[model samples]
Target: MVLRIFGLSFAVTVVSIIIAALYGGPQAVLLVVILSILEISLSFDNAVINATVLRRMSEFWQKIFLTVGIVIAVFGMRLVFPLVIVWLASGLGPVLALDLALNPPADDAAYFPDGSPSYETLLTDAHPQIAAFGGMFLLMLFLGFILEEREITWLSWLEKPLARAGKLDQLAVIVAGGLLLLTASYIAPEDTVSTVMVAGVLGMITYIAVNGLGELFNTPEEDENGEVVEGSSGGPTELAKATGKAGFFLFLYLEVLDASFSFDGVIGAFAITSDPIIIALGLGFVGAMFVRSITVFLVRKGTLSDYVYLEHGAHWAIGALAVILLVSIGYHVNENVTGLVGVALIGAAFISSILRNRKAAAAGGSSDNDVDEPKPVTIS
Candidate 1:
């Protein structure tokens, strides 16, 4: 599995480089490779998060993530997202940005610098929005923790009255969406309101659609052929039917989650070099590769259940990413610090988890076996 994953990673890199070369020559390939690494580094937290949830997905859904998701992430999000941002922020249309990206209308070779987009200007122009976006996301995370800590049961009053109301965890999704929208309007400045709102609505829509579909399509199990009939207590063991609603929602959430993870790196990529094309080349492919790699690792390693805090770490990362995106609305976001903070927290958690498990093992007096701990990531 490791070898297969590596082979695929290598193939992806080679193919991306070849595409870059064919389209824009050697410089583009070099730019892409660098961007790819930067993206992967910026999004280490995302890999961990993907590992946690991808494990829950059906094999078919997992395959979609590996094949289809990467395409949207690299080309659509990394390469095009920036331009789209600029287009929305300023009156510069995407076509104009694309044109500028292809052939920068700069006179001096020093400024033109291999015909890359003037990412320096963009960096200065977009940092506050970046900072605001990230800041808001973090606030949401912290707020969520506080809210979760509260004795707010899942519609406790309503559920108690109506026993068959079913569990209502959708509040978290709705609250997340509402918070994002509120942040977009008030927390984020005038400029990035659109971007943050877009992201929030996108997330909320995914959460709602998936869950609603799951509920709508869920059956009484026994009617389906060879199915594990679920009667809330005693049921045979059969893979529950997927109405595709849950998968769709998971896909949507995963995409948003991926976006949240990639935001810091996307913004930070400009700091590495003031070349948008280079930024795209480096971060896009690398981010895509990491996503693919994590998916494979989770499937093969079977380590998701072993590391409980990893998912927690990922959610924290997502929260952090959301804050980072929000803060980008109005402040300067440092890539190194952002990456470091997440890495440190997750590392601490991993250490604590290991220590806790060790203590438990000692108390139980199990055989002298060392638990294989998964590595910690820098981001969620």
Candidate 2:
């Protein structure tokens, strides 16, 4: 299963290296390798979250995620997204933005003469709004999950209290709003404060709107003998069947989720090399392929249900990432530091999961085989 899942990823890696070598020789090849590794490390949590969501989606959507989703990730987010940022920041058209990307100025002064921000500079100027939007979106995701009551928790001592507090109406939104105000005031520049705040609010609104619509339009499940079983009315249910509207929204959700995850990596890639094509080749293609491979592996192995608290850990990591992104609006955080924090949090959760499994075995609750084995999936 591992080999089969990763076969395409490996091929992509080779292609990335060849592209780099042809584009910029041995040095660029090395850059591509490093950037790919960096993206994978920074995005491990993304893979886990993707798996969590993908497993619930219909098989058709899963295939769409693999095929169509990759196009959006590699081309839309990595390529066009940056160009769009440049266009917005510099008031340049798409062709002009593409030109600036292909032909960057000799120095920062040249940018002023042309009245156009270089691609990298435009991306840098747009960082605050990008960070605010992605951060708030990620915060909402984390808060929504953490605030929900769950049977299994990695950090029971704290999680139990948070779960109790979950009963508060609109608690996540309120906290997210408060954080947005505080974050905007503290980190955003005086001129860009309103932009930051507005972006943050839009991020929150996007999350609420997408989720609300998904829940409202979610279809009922069909049981054996082709009978329609009514689904729960109070909350959103996993999509059992992918209709046109439902599937589109799920696709949108995943794409937005991918964009949020890519924001940091895209920015961080500039720190390594300013050549947009190389960055796209390394992080966009190679790194994204591996992420998809990891997601598929996790889903096929039933890793989430087996480990139990792994999802909790991923959400916590996301919260930490959200905070870091918002703080980065004012501060220069090393990407290595951000990546390590996620690794540490997820690592601790994995350990906790192991300990829980041992305890369950000792209590004769379930054997390792019972826990780790993948269950049959119903894909309609």
Candidate 3:
């Protein structure tokens, strides 16, 4: 079953490794392998959150996620997005950016020292804006999750209070907006403050617009009494049936979510290697495939339902990542630190979920063990 689901991903992994080997031999192969690992480490939490959303979607939309969505994630965000950033940052056309990437000059050979400020350098220079946009979008996502009233709680001490506080309407937006302004004032450079602030605002607005659009078009269903419910009932099968225009918006939301996760991964890749092609080939291919595979596994196996608190943990990890992204704008956080924090939090949550399930099972067994099943009455 696992092979059936992840066959394409395994194929892509082989192809990516072969391409890496062909391009730069053994050294390049090793680097691609390392980058792929790094991308996966940074994005495991992403898969969990994606599963949480994907399970709510219909099978058709889920297929879209694995098919059309992967294309956008691999090529659109991983490959072209950085080039677009460089083009915009350098005030040069896309062609010039592509040229510079293709034929990088020798060290100290061009006008600027060390090969005319490599693609990595250009991207690093634009970090403030990237941080602003990605950080804000992620922040909104984290806030929305934490501020929602949920029955289950992973970290009850923290989450319970937040859920209580969520009663204030739009509190998440207000808090997120205030934090953005605070970051702009204190953390952002004086010259780039306005740019960062604008980008952050835009990020928040984008989240709101996407979320609102999805809700606006959702087809309400009538219950037995003919009362209209906001969304379809039951699992993915029901969702798949009713999803139409709203499903498209949901697709848009997932793309944006994936982009927010990729933002950090893309920037972090430069720390390992500055070659844009290598980054795309390694992280874009392997990272995306593995994450998608994990998402499918969770949905097919009903992992979320079996381990209820897993979703809670994933959301908490997201909240942590969102804050880390925002803090990274001011401080130089090690990529390892960023990745490990998420892993640790999610791991702890998984353990908690296992313990809870065991406890529940034990309690249920204790109660029912003494109760005998009714003796079968045989008709002679």
Local distance difference test, each candidate? 0.57, 0.82, 0.78
TM-score ranking, high to low: 2, 3, 1
- Superposed Cα deviation of residue 342, candidate 2 (Å): 1.2
Evaluation by TM-score, superior candidate among 1 and 3: 3
lDDT per residue as tens, model 2, 1-380: 67798999999998888888988999999988888988998999988888777765678887888899999999898888998988877877888778778888677456456555567877988999999999998999898888887656678789989989989999999999999999888877788899899989999998888777666666656668777764422122232554566666766787888898898999999999888888888888999999989888878877887787677788899999999999988888999988998888888888888888888888888743242323534322
Which residue pairs overlap in candidate 2's backbone? none
Better of 2 and 3 by lDDT: 2
lDDT of 1 by residue, 1-380 (tens): 57766677777677778878887787777778777766666576677766654544556777787778888888877778777766655445678666655665555243444543353465356655444444444444333332332121222344243333223454455556666767777766776678657655654554445435544544433544856544411101112333365555556556755665665677677666555666666777755776668666754665444544454555555566666555556555677667776776566656655665677677985323333333422111
Query: How far off is residue 91 in model 1, in Å?
Result: 4.7
Report the CA-based lDDT of candidate 3 relative to the real structure: 0.78
Q: Is candidate 1 or candidate 2 better by lDDT?
A: 2
Which residue pairs in model 3 clash with each other? none
